[model samples]
Target: MGNSSSIQAADASGFTQSRSLSRSFFGAAALALVIILPGCATYSSGFAKVEQAAAVRDLDGAVKTLDELKLTGADEALHHLNKGTLLRLQGNYAESNKHFDIAKELADKLNAISVSEQLASVSVNDTMKAYEGLPSEQLMLYSFKALNYLQMSDVDAAAVEARQFDIKQSQIAKQNADAKYLSGAFVRYLNAMVYEAAGERDSARIELQKALDGYKKQNSGFPVPASLTADLARIKAGKPAPSEVVFILQNGLGPSLHEATVRIANPNPQNGSSLLSLAVPKLAKRSVPVARIELSAGSAVASAEVVEDVNDIAEKSLNDRLPGITARAVARMVVKNAAVGETKKRSNELGAFGLLANIAMDVGSAVSERADTRTWSLLPGVINMARLPLPAGKHDITATYYSESGAVLATRVFKDIEIKPGRKAFVSDYYLNPPAQAKAPQ
Candidate 1:
């Protein structure tokens, strides 16, 4: 939904002007703006190849392709994040945390750069610049890092990551107080689970309450999870049990970014009334693998509920970023217009060369006007979780990933799941899409 107003905003009186097209270099500049800029790379489509690998359950191939990509600056952070997520899926917790830690550091460093970087972007092309990640993606980085710690049974590190998630969520909320929607229940709930695992009942109870508040704020019509309610009840009864197993399910791929072209009217209305265009990023929806998951440990069975809607997170994060994007686009257009106007004021041979040079620059800008389309493409469209209490010993749990129609998509039997006394077991899985249900990139 970015820069949707580019055309309407350009039609304002500020862009209306009368100029001599025959004598001035206005004709060439207008022509360049109209023809060259629209040819820019609107969005990158190479991620489709990785998705293709994933469709056939080729995890190693997906990671290999993603790793082979040469990335620089902000894109490097995305590289780390995406690879870390894939590694986690491969059950490489230690290696995954290493990459995720690097990603977190890079994200902070890139985000701290001054907004002035956008000015440099006007001339150098936006795609050449660093890629500061979306807030939702940033938050997910921490969530995954915590999950990595959980898988390794490092409660201390996991708790630290959970605290960082809370801090980041608060910061995002403060930045976008007027946003239409922004809330995440899973992070806090997971935090509570970690605290409970660490034998910190008070902190666990507090986090559970916070998680409940987040659900209330969402107001998205989802019922409060009965599992959460039961956990809270047990915590209130001074039963800080560690024999519980939590299954974290990541389901499907989130939406991808695309480009939309906005046609702006010529600044000088007399120049054949040609239209100039701007390219802005947009989010395109896609189908997810499953809506809910059911976990069965012998006779005890429970259904996983949505803890995080990654699709909504991506959409909200983009909407929150639209204001800054629109402002930068407006500023860049103003600079282009001023450059063209100055070219017209001079009447010497050098001025004629200046006009040609400006035309060339416009063409370059058009070629480089690519949208920052890098994201954690392998991440699930939604995250769900189920908790089951079991006796301290090796056990078998079967997880059934299914669709809204109650159709069984995939059934995974996790054998020899070990539960320890006063320590919980964490299991994780992701379903990109049911076999035979994969859709080709549009």
Candidate 2:
């Protein structure tokens, strides 16, 4: 393609020589879209600075960077999701939940009908529409909310969030009856734990059974922890623990996204829309640095078992929705072709400007054919848990993160971790194998 400014100058000189005002206006507008729109960045690309800050475990810096991106209305949902995560990591549960609540509300609003965004999605690109997080992501959002509430020492709010997670997961499961599910065993287990902590044995028993069933049903490339079965039995037989410490380990960064483009002939030639390419989002799975986290307190030691594989769930969720995503992308290509053809027919009235319009539309379409790669990128790749029964007392807590090889990766020490009688102490941590490379751009 020739330089846009040079071509525009040449076109303008011709228009001025002919003294055609109408042609000049149309040429200016069409060429502007072609030149300016093509330089527009994808949603994922805007996160470079945010990812860099987050990689260094600078939660505040990451949030600031994300806020500085100055995203559009379409990016509001993702902005809140990212900020919520950053705040959540900062241990500011209140602030995190505030952003998360706003995010959830935005997602709900986005789900409602919006003809302009919908049309734009089909004609320009998927990112034209407001971001609606995947089902698994919504679940994760709820899980995070529940965890935030738990961390705030509000068992009631946590239970409510947990129940909401279950309800939403069940609805999604019913809708995708044929497909494998995330099963949401972790949330159910968390609900049970919350109940147990609140001394609600019956409710705990019910959620525990569901959790046990969920783990058995889910194949997240991890074995169902033996503790779940034992917990079920103990709960059923009314064996209440004296005290416990539940470790919730978020392992590695969640899979981010990248675009995959392919040029192919229009599938439906009869539609009067000729197109050559499609761009769709694909999962960019990150490497897991730590296989599991081991927690040791005095003489008692337990390894947190993987319960949810965020990578696997994200892959499955995208696969479940790929056909629709690709269909929209194909439709976008067709619309672009149609637009280019229409531009050629209308702009021809301007003589030389017709070719300019054609070039602008063609190049603009090619450049704008990016996939909607927005996602909750800061989520954990895998979730692991360990319920260790300990006597009520202060003890030095040591957490060791290990690699798949038996090599130690990192360790954390929490001095004077207190376990109260008949109460559950919660410990949560996030681990990224190599923090700096967590969200390396593709």
Candidate 3:
């Protein structure tokens, strides 16, 4: 975007700003380096334990492990997101919303940090800073929070989240309208359902249309649910549709993050060409088959189909970020290499003390080279949904989880679920096959 000299000048400015933030720069930097380098991988092992607990359907064990996480600095956002989702799956709606609310606030604060933080990251590593969260994760905060409100029968609160989701979508559009969806079709669909629950059919119809239009734009190869179309038709004709039992399914585990290396050619060819590389973390998709669920009430049965594959959403969201990540990594590498060159030049001029300084800088560089691999890892691979109309009364419903090849894996039965006339009943479940190896971020 500018000449090489100007870019280097900007880097120097960044360094100056970072230094101005502290009185004891060297001491603070050293302590930060020590704390961050070792603490970066702290959550991985603990989250693995949480994953193990979740695998066996031990909700209490999962919560216990989650509560034990050493959440500080960049770990805070990820910790809240994971803890919140886990609690939601565990049927702790109010508690889950509390965590999610904290996550949203932290994410907003992180996203609004000073430019000096960006510059500091060049030398200290991104993980040494706060986690700003992925776009998908940010949108998901509202989605889940809205669902939590719905579960509590607080339709007004859920509508607030729906409005917030729209605001985020508008901001994303302003930034880059041509980019893929900021929020997914499923979120919009949920918004419509929420509006409908609040006796706002006109608003619901509008949201339903947006949902249909957004899904078409997503082009994710998933067809619009037949039942959704029927609902839209009924809403358009002003005919009241039956109150239904809705299942929001989180199936399998989401992708995991790992590190990879990228090499950049020397920017200044006259200084003798060299290859510079940085280890960058990226999301690696774990293969999990698309999931389906069958809901049965006595002899009548209905199938739950995949409406939103969150794994696909995460993949696309990460993919959209690849260009920005590469650019930032390249810029950071350039700044760090320049710092090394400056230090080496001073070392040659000042003898022993400068030599020690240069050595210390080298050690810091090596230790701080890791990629930022933090995420809300416990998210489901896919989100399947189904709506079944039931007469206003208490009824027993059975939900069967199935694998990709139509093999039944597990079944859960809920007895005496009460459905009120002209009102929606909500139900949800999580199911996955056990992982072959331990994974973190749940």
lDDT of each: 0.71, 0.77, 0.74
The regions of model 1 sitting more than 4 angstroms off are 1-44, 122-129, 179-183, 265-275, 341-362, 365-367, 434-436, 440-442
**Candidate 3, poorest ten consecutive residues by summed lDDT:** 268-277
- Number of residue pairs clashing in candidate 1, backbone atoms closer than 3 angstroms, sequence gap of 3 or more or interchain: 1
Clashes of each: 1, 0, 2
Report clash pairs, candidate 1: 252-381
Looking at model 3, residue 270 earns an lDDT score of: 26
Residue lDDT tens for model 3, 66-144? 8888777767878889889889988899999999989888887877787877766665566666776787778778878
- Tens digit per residue, CA lDDT, model 1, 1-442: 4475776666653344223323345555554565355344322345666667766768799889876665555477777778888888889999999988888888778866656666555633455456657766776677788888988889999988877888888887787676534555667778888888777789889888877877777654566677777778889888766577789888888888776656666767222222444556688767877866889988988788887777877887787776776666556555655554454344223354545645554454444344455567777887888888788998899999877787888899999999898678999988876346676547
Q: Where is model 2 more than 4 Å wrong at Cα?
A: 1-39, 264-275, 435-442
* Residue 41 lDDT in candidate 3: 53
TM-score of 1: 0.82
User: 99-134 in candidate 2: lDDT tens per residue?
Assistant: 999999887777674999888778777787888787
State every prediction's TM-score relative to the real structure.
Answer: 0.82, 0.88, 0.84
